[model samples]
Target: MDIIKKRRSVREYLDKPVEDEKIEQIVEAARLAPSSCNSQCWRFVVTKGDIKEQIIKKGLGGIVLANRWAKSAPAIIVACADLNFLTHKVGAGIKGIEYHLLDIGIAVEHLILRATELGLGTCWIGWFNEREVRKILKIPRSIKIVALITLGYPKGELELHEKQRLDLKKILFWNKYGNCEG
Candidate 1:
């Protein structure tokens, strides 16, 4: 819970480099996330230095706000999933496709939590141009890019903002969807 509360979408980063061993540990955590039918179709592309810069540029080409923060991150982990491997085993159906995406999401969350525990910061980036990113990374067509994660040591403390959320009383119901005060 400490790691969950401390984790934030950190955009600013220090110039220091993250250790290779720490990166490996973070990846290991992601590898251990539960996958549907234990297919484990996810693959990670770890980028640093010049490669990281190129990916950031290509991925953020259309998003102005994201480009600013992504440029500062010391490393970027692009999560991709082999679509064929995940769905083929399940046969032809939409359920298999859904499982692949769900599995990727779970894996990425595990990565973020592990990074937080290691005193590192990460931001889940979803607004990137996926087609451009695939070209930049030379990712084959067989895989679907799930997300691009930016990682580094935070430049400063995270400031909490007062964001609106649905109250439990309004959202929770005894058994059905519209009933409140159950």
Candidate 2:
């Protein structure tokens, strides 16, 4: 719960290098995440140096808001999945696309939680030009890029701000839709 509460979309970061061992631990946590049919089609590309810079530039073309902050992070993890492997197994037909995406989401959340536990920060970046990213990373056409996560130590304390959300009465129903009162 403490880690959950501390997990925030940190945009700013300190100019400090994250240890490789810590990075490995975070990836290990993600690796242990549940997958659809235990297929585990997810692939992680950890980026740094010129390659990371190129990814940040090409990737941010679609996202106008977090481009600047994304460039500042020390490292970026490009999450990709083999489409065929995820949907088909041992000559099987398409199982479900939703399952693949859900599996990736679960893995990403595990990464975020592990980052928080390690006193690090992370921001899940989804708004990117997939084609550009594919080209930048030299990923094969058969693979699908799911998300890009920026990781680093936070620059400062994050202030809790009010977030808009649906009320319990509006969102929850006793047994059917629209049955609860405000």
Candidate 3:
């Protein structure tokens, strides 16, 4: 199986810390991710130690209880997009498409996949108070927070079961929606 297929969204993590070199690899994957029109507007804020704790306990605000499991993770990577890029401005103006968010999403997937390949656990977090996170990270208001990914080692024996997904026949159509053979 491909590493991408093996990747799972892990919530529980061991208290062990991720090595700096591994972190570098994960960030490098994000850096190399393809961006729409090569906008490369994604920005990542890596939180460790005390800052990591603060992000979980405070930055997440009332949603903390829902994602409390991630608080134990040794590192939390916050993904953001710098909307100041010319492609973002032009695309949004001309086509009403937000390419920066797409770029950030692709970059985050790369980071998470790299972490998983390196034997690290990761959980992608999107529900939270963006304002609070931006304030805590000291990010400028012009930037848009995209997502958060927590990283660490697995807490126990890891196993992979068959993933539940829609059948290809049910989701795929030859030419358009409802065009599949009946």
Per TM-score, the best of the predicted structures is: 3
Candidate 3 lDDT tens digits, 58-147: 777685568877878899999999878887888989999888988998899999888878989898888877777877889998899889
What is the TM-score (0 to 1) of candidate 3? 0.92
TM-scores of all predicted structures: 0.87, 0.86, 0.92
Off by over 4 Å in 1: 63-65, 86-97, 158-164
Scored against the true structure, residue 76 in model 1 reaches a CA lDDT of 94
Better of 1 and 3 by TM-score: 3
- The lDDT for every candidate, in the order shown, is 0.84, 0.81, 0.85
User: What are the runs in model 2 whose C-alpha is more than 4 Å off?
Assistant: 62-66, 86-97, 158-164
TM-score of 2: 0.86
The residue pairs found clashing in candidate 2 are: none
- Residue 130 of model 3 has an lDDT of 79
Worst 10 residues of 2 by lDDT: 86-95
Q: Pick the candidate with the highest lDDT.
A: 3
